[model samples]
Structure formats: structure tokens, C-alpha cells
Target: MDILSTVELNDCPLCLGPGLLEEEGGHCVYATCLDCGCHTVPVNYRTEAEKLDAAQRVAHLWNVGKVISEGVGE
Candidate 1:
């Protein structure tokens, strides 16, 4: 599997933790992380290409932290 599928396999890409609960939001699908006790929209990916794109973006965020861990970790 690619990175996007790999990432989604673990948990929510936003929080990057366990206990991710899926919530349908109109046109978008949302998943919440339970470990950090925070909510996130994660990367907005569509098709396989989109998923890959989003996965790459999310990987950057995961490494940089600033992209997602705002007010959560410093």
C-alpha cells in the first residue's frame, strides 16, 4: 500500500494518534484522534493521486509539527 493508505491504516493523520473516530461531514470525512485528545480535518485528499498528495503534505506536517501541532505541542 502507498503512504496515504499506510497513514490511514494507523490512525488519523491529523493527530497521528490512536482512537480516531470517523465522523461524516456533508462532503468530507473527518477523523478525530483520541490520544492527543484533539480534533483535526487531516489532509484533504480525493482520488489515489489526491490521497498520495495529501499523504505527502501530511508527512511534512508530521515532521515539521508546526503544520498541525498548533497549541498542542511546542
Candidate 2:
């Protein structure tokens, strides 16, 4: 698995679906659920060095069920 895959996230709190890690333009990261459209707020970062930290924070938010129920993909 890749480094991001190793970040770890729980099943979707809303629908028990698989969680996805999304990085936007290398500026922010967030976690999203594929099934029920649940997602965590994006964590912004200033530099490439901060990407990992932001991703990890989003993953933690996702694991703890801190998410918004709107689908970004849909």
C-alpha cells in the first residue's frame, strides 16, 4: 500500500462504507465516504511539508465520526 493508505481510517459513521482520502491541489486533505456521502472538512496546509500533517488530521476526524453528510463526488 502507499503511504496515504497507511494513514488509517474507520468505516463511514453514516453508512459503514469504505473511506477515501482526498488531496486537493496539494493544498488540503479530507476524508470521504463512498457510500453515504459523508466527509470530513478539509484541512488546509501551507507547504508540501504540511500535506502529511493535514492528511493525518483529516483521517483522525474521519475515524472519530466528525464529518459532514454532503457528497463532494455527487
Candidate 3:
């Protein structure tokens, strides 16, 4: 499955505005908005359908607005 063919570059949930930078590394792919420091998890999906499902889950979680932060020491 091709990431570019499955994902929409413009409709990034993390971006929430516009101009998202899509990045792919190792076993996952995600989008990021540098201005907001917002990004999606590098979902480990083997198929295009799985990737879409994972993206939906991530978007839902982001929409819920329950952010969890951890300290370096912790």
C-alpha cells in the first residue's frame, strides 16, 4: 500500500489549520505542523486500509483533546 495514494495531504487533523508536512520514516508514516508542534503517531500499518483506520483513530483521539505529557525524568 502506498501512503501517498491512501492519505490526503491537505486534511491533516493535527494541523487543524493548513500546511502540514507529511513525513515517512522507518515502519510508520505521519503528518506534522511545525507551527503548532502538532503531529500524528507513526502508525504501524501494513495495508492502506489499516493506515486509514489508524489515522481515523488518531484523529478521534486528537479531537477529544486529552493530551498526555511526560517529563524527561519520568
Candidate 4:
């Protein structure tokens, strides 16, 4: 089974809008919001917990109004 199929994603924490999940080399990477252009950091495929942690961190930063740098997860 694909790793992505097992993961669950939430709306953009910044704008509470829809977003797209990015992938590279067949691995789940980051998520980007369609409305605000905010995105999460590229998550490593080491473990499921790590992936979720990265996503949560991104959401937390957005929630606190921190500016996420661009060109990430490219």
C-alpha cells in the first residue's frame, strides 16, 4: 500500500481553506494551501509519526502568524 493512502490531511491552518499535498520520489512531502500559499516543511519518510509531527509543526507556525519561507519542498 502507498504511504500517502494511509495519511490524513487537514485544511490549511492559516486560511482554513483547501490545500494540495506534494510528493517527490514516490514519498509524501509537504502540503500547500491553495488560498494563502502557505506550505509545510518537507517531511522525511522515516516514520509515520515524524510525518505527522512535521505537518503539525507547519500548522502551528501558520496559526501563530509566522511567515513560511518559499521555495521549500521543491
Candidate 5:
């Protein structure tokens, strides 16, 4: 299984700012740091359906993950 398959916030590595953290990619979580202008993506977990159910959350996770790994948000 790829890194994404085994990702979960509980076991994730990076710790970012508050406000609903989400997966940043294969092994990361990204969040917009209000404290800092730089978009921050802390190494985190897979976007779980149960944990993150809203469309905005899902999309945000995807975008954040993409940005962290691929350097662009979709």
C-alpha cells in the first residue's frame, strides 16, 4: 500500500496550527497559518470519510495535500 493508504491523523508526524488539520499528501497535513502567510502542510494523514465528511473539508484536504507534495493545489 502507498503512504496515503496508511495515513491517519493519530499516527501522523507533523504538527501544524489549529483548526481541523487535514492530510497534505502521502504523509502530511496542510493548513493556512493565519499567523504566517506561508501555506503550511504538516506531515499528516489520509482524508478519512468519517473524520472529514464535508465537501469543503474533503476538497480542502485534497488541495492541501496536493500543494504539499506536488507544489500545487487542485
Candidate 6:
């Protein structure tokens, strides 16, 4: 999770709130909005070395408004 802190991200596109990088099961990374529950598609990684690139990919998706919001708010 420490490595994920290096990735920069934009504000949440759906709620304009703060966003952070999230790791799933120690194998994938994605960006998510803490306030609105919006998240980008997870990028899978096979090895520990690929985690950085995976984090960057998801960050890019999130920064460009490519996130998915399935909850009530838009």
C-alpha cells in the first residue's frame, strides 16, 4: 500500500471529492472516491513489480473521468 501513495490522482469526477488509490487483495490497484463510492476499473498485476504500473494505469483512468459509479449519486 505504501507504493500506491506515489500515484497522483485528480478529484472525483462524480462527486468532486477527494480520491485515493486502492489495492485489492494485494494483486490489483484502482482509484476510488471516498465520499461518493466511485471507482475506476481495477488493473490487475501478476507480480509485485507490476504494482506500480498497475497503479499508474488505474490513476490515468480515474484522472480522465473513466470511473464507474454504481451508487445513487451521479
Model-by-model lDDT, in order? 0.46, 0.84, 0.48, 0.60, 0.37, 0.90
**All candidates' TM-scores?**
0.41, 0.83, 0.46, 0.50, 0.21, 0.89
lDDT of 1 by residue, 1-74 (tens): 53434553344445566734232332233334566644444656456566555555554444443233344465
lDDT of 2 by residue, 25-73 (tens): 8678899988987789999998755777888899999988899986553
Minimum summed lDDT over a 10-residue window in model 3 is located at: 65-74
Q: Model 6: how far is 38 from its true place, Å? A: 0.7
CA lDDT, candidate 4, residue 37: 86
Off by over 4 Å in 2: 71-74
The reply for model 5, stretches above 4 Å from the true place, is 1-23, 33-36, 41-43, 50-74
On lDDT, the leading prediction is 6
Candidate 5 yields a Cα-based lDDT of 0.37
Q: Write the per-residue lDDT of candidate 4 for residues 1-74, one digit (tens) a residue.
A: 55444545566766777766666554446667787787766665556666566555544544554535453553
* TM-score, ranked from best to worst: 6, 2, 4, 3, 1, 5
Worst 10 residues of 2 by lDDT: 65-74
- After TM-score superposition, the amount by which residue 29's alpha carbon in candidate 3 deviates from its true location, in angstroms, is 3.8
State each candidate's clash count. Answer: 0, 0, 0, 0, 6, 0
- Per-residue alpha-carbon lDDT of model 5 for 1-74, expressed as tens digits? 33333333221112343233445444444444332233433543446443333334433553444323233444
> Which pairs clash in model 2?
none
lDDT per residue (tens digit) for residues 1-74 in model 6: 58888889999998899999988888888899999888999999988779999998999999899999988654
After superposition on all CA atoms, what RMSD does each candidate show versus the true structure?
A: 5.7, 3.8, 5.3, 5.6, 11.5, 1.9
- What is the Cα-based lDDT of residue 22 in candidate 1? 38
lDDT (tens digit, per residue) of candidate 3 on 1-74? 54444444454344355434243654455555545655655556677667666665544444454222232322
